[model samples]
Target: MTCLFRRIRFVLPTCLAGVLLAGCAPNPEIATVTVPRAAQHVSPAARALLPDPNPPYTPASYQSRSLAAYYGHMQDKLLASGKLRQDTGQGVAITADQLTKDFIDIAMKDEYMRGGSGTMHRSMDSVLRRWEKPIRVFTVFGATVPPTERERANALVASYVNRLARVTGHDIQMTTRENANYYVMFMGEDDRMPFGETLKAAIPEIDPATMNVFKHTPRNQLCVALTFREQNGSPVMGKALAMIRSEHPQILRLSCLHEEMAQALGLPNDSPTARPSIFNDDEEFALLTTHDELLLRILYDRRLKPGMTQEQALPIVRQIAGELVGR
Candidate 1:
């Protein structure tokens, strides 16, 4: 059965090995696009809540540099061990039956549940959720992040969002923060404290527990996404917020972008059995996989509506999976 609640998904720093190493080079295509500066789009209301656009780069900047180095080292180790596969096409062959099961596990489950007092507890249960309205993604960056980095992030997100739209057949596009229903913020170490106010300004009804997690997310928790339903007992997602640690180096940051943004769309749970997919916690795939594209297609398929119980959705999911896999 489906349970209605806000869903928060976290991507852990799991390791695996594979070929097809993802190069750290920035995309030349995205670089050509003239990205609007993030500071220019910040609303007057949100401006006061956010960190300064040009704060003195000092202690926090130092910490962020250190973090970048550490994560860079970690990425090197992961690459050496053959983890973080960017070649999505070269993974284990997935069958129709396996795809169906994976869809149910990833799409119809809640990764974190909220207690009566508004604290989050790790729990698992059925919950069918997806966006009914068009998705407009807006990104914001912390003061410490440089202009070049911001441009790279903007281009990456824009390109990825378009790819997602094409995969899901959903109306997803990047917009200004003022007009976006989905907010993606890249915050550095110094921006942690002020991030709460920024979130409050953006979503006044945000849960304190969720804010706490964003403010003090553990280093191991690479990135997070929180999706809110229209109302209690409702399955339609109305808003979403994703916080990515700006300290992450390029590949890890892109990995976070792929997983967290996709999770925010609806697939909020990870399955160890999900092969060659970013939805799995194994970190085998650094980017969205061919398997994952099919999953998104199934999620937005017209036959399976939001709030559907597992029993109500599984038959349709299986059929869709078979059709997608040509079974």
Candidate 2:
């Protein structure tokens, strides 16, 4: 099969969706990014503890129509999981040797489609025509963490931010640093497994020290928020609370602290892949933060409270800024 209908122009930012559609609008238009420090191959005592993947929010772009019926109900659950073979050839053509192997595996049995990425790499590439499908991604982090390594880096940043914000509804920035010590090489083919059997086959009802692989990062005092659509307030939480009131003014604000961040991330915040639920559906509206302040902002679309007017919020502010620092 062969297809190419390139027409994507996402824009969102009308005073951060009027402060999440109802926080009483106003306050947004900040957005910044710069997390770079943590190379030298870690281990100087875990590079003195790591965390800081650029911060200063403004990263939102979720598609709709109920996400095209949730990507055709996840491609009819990977073609009815009969594990491929329903004439795998045509049905979505793509000659040129499958776009130079730029992906082609439509689920069949989902092994993250041979390599990594998910949604079986966009349902084997045929570029998801009409029947609906389009997935985007953005994952970020950083931490050296404190409070005596706060229960294994906040239970590995709350089960890796509830398993990548349930597959990427975007928004979950955490930072904290001094020296550094990062390394999350989860390649593929079970990528050499054993991070306690990959968080117990993706958080099987937690408990294992709340699925701990020797703790990572997590404490508190960090800030940033977003992930609400049709809510009437949220240009990524008015650009992460207007950059935590101008450059992290000792950030501190918590609402759904999920049982005190799962008891300071000792783990088990109802695991089953942790929280968020395998991504998309606008990733169940993302936006989360913590790990000792300064970074992970993200905003735009004027309507910013305290009397709005940043040129009415520069045309849906969004200009890339993902920096989980190092590997």
Candidate 3:
């Protein structure tokens, strides 16, 4: 299975695209009321450079609220990026069984979250948390990228944010302001390695040394994008970093944008078995799929909480997955 990172971009239905990107906050229209229809499933593009599990997961060192605030931020985001496809399909017909099967396979098993640098084995407790209360918004910017690349990056990211909001019914939004907690940026070749310093400067919680390893390690094997975070003990992801190789072909660039952006939302691991998904190493689909969207919906559902074990979450996941079908 040579995952092909095809060149593709699917245009959203005129009405839906307008509604999702319709207006700004407060009396929110797109994220609050709009629900895009689920289209049929289609097979698509290939691979991404997923983050290897390094340093492993360790319980946070004890710190008082004042000190923790001074020393740390949000919880860790699983780093996952992807290969892309020929086009963004309308969507797939994801039935209840398909939904549960894919969700369980992705959510319950350790194998699904495999990384390259080291093996990451975890208990079920980590699968649970999400942005239950906090704001979910992102702003796109440039690194060494020129105006044209920045513009293209912003547009591609905006499309996925709309798709993510509609599919999951979460309050995810895209903005041009400085308040965005999640930041997606395009990095030109010259700005690549040093971009980690830029991230550390903006959000001091990020370890600059780790960013160095991340940027350099992936370049050796192309098609890798990165999504890191500044998170505390809770499952809620506060700040995230998405970096795309600015010089990639439009298709691969678009592909990296889709995977890294989606992964930052909580589905951070890549499973080889995740068919028809960008979250898999197989690179079966370059663009995000209906199955992946349902996973997003399940993750943000009010019934589920952050930091739940597989033992605690399976039943609730099934319940939510049941209602999501044919909706």
Candidate 4:
């Protein structure tokens, strides 16, 4: 058998460490990527249903590390059975060439790796590294969600949670807010101010500016969300706060939810070449594809450690990406 992972001479790019580090007064900079809207999306039918009421108080949620770990193990039993099938994707091929290209494009680039004007050309392995720990997600909704809306969000979450678990192959589980590492939200149209405030309170020692960024939406972002990782004397673990505008069409909101959470898991970049994938700014696929699943698998693979540089992990990534394509 040929040894696929051989040592390579690639050097660690300069900025990746800063993106992954933690400390007070440490650069208040973190990679923030915009999930730009697809070139075009059809608008859903509008209605003037009963107005949504605001919450009496701004709401926030968090989980203890212990419970997050414990329940994550409980979820492993469910995810162990998930199989990424080649035939599950639409218009995507089951070939190694495409898989190799995707792994390199996604795993080795920063979120801003776009070429000048409509072409994606920036390239580097400066994307943040990995989580040394399991992550559990919990869903919360703004007061704007009616019983019917809550049912829709919760049902969608229930299924997406399983997919998240399978992709990470880690202790990625979903339970009530009491023990979640990630707090997913369904925000009402009127809840933007309260929602941003909730985020500022939920993350500790976060930048005032970063927190403030959440308060405003770019013209291109229909449903918006962001993820942050905190380091407690160890490599940081990701916690995401994802929200979809409750008043938007069901399909558009779901697309936002999918991209934000998945991007939070370390593959923070979007590549035009990634086909039938949620990572693309293009709204090509509504669900996770085999290609996307394999990328997540590579990120969480045992051969790659949490803080390893792209150069350090490249060989192992090559091996794992190849295996995912073949198997």
Model 3 CA deviation exceeding 4 Å by range: 1-84, 87-95, 108-125, 133-144, 214-217, 220-231
Residue-wise C-alpha lDDT for candidate 4, range 1-327, written one tens digit per residue: 111111011111222210111121122111233222111111222111212322343322232233224323322321332311224365666555666567666665664432334343434555435555677777777765666777777778878878878778777777655445566777654565665664544444334544554565432234444544454322344455665655445544665577667766766665677776765543345557777888888888887776666677667777777777663
Please provide TM-scores, in order, for all candidate models, with all chains considered together.
0.81, 0.18, 0.64, 0.67
Cα lDDT, all candidates: 0.69, 0.21, 0.47, 0.52
lDDT: which is higher, 1 or 3?
Answer: 1
- By lDDT, the better pick of 2 and 3 is 3
Give one digit per residue, the lDDT tens place, for model 2 in 1-327.
222111111112121110111222222121111111111222344422322232223222232233324334433433343211222122233222222121111101111121222122211211110001111122222221123323443454456555433433333334333221111211111111223343222212223432331222111112222111211331111111001111111111111222122111111111112122111111121223221100111111111221222232222111211211111
TM-score (C-alpha, index-matched) for candidate 3? 0.64
lDDT of 1 by residue, 159-190 (tens): 99999999999999998655787877888877
TM-score of 2: 0.18
Residue clash pairs of candidate 4: 115-121
Q: For residue 204, what is the lDDT in candidate 1?
A: 57
Question: What is the alpha-carbon lDDT for the whole of candidate 4?
Answer: 0.52
Cα-based RMSD of the predictions, in order? Answer: 9.6, 22.5, 17.7, 15.9
Better of 2 and 3 by TM-score: 3
TM-score ranking from best candidate downward: 1, 4, 3, 2
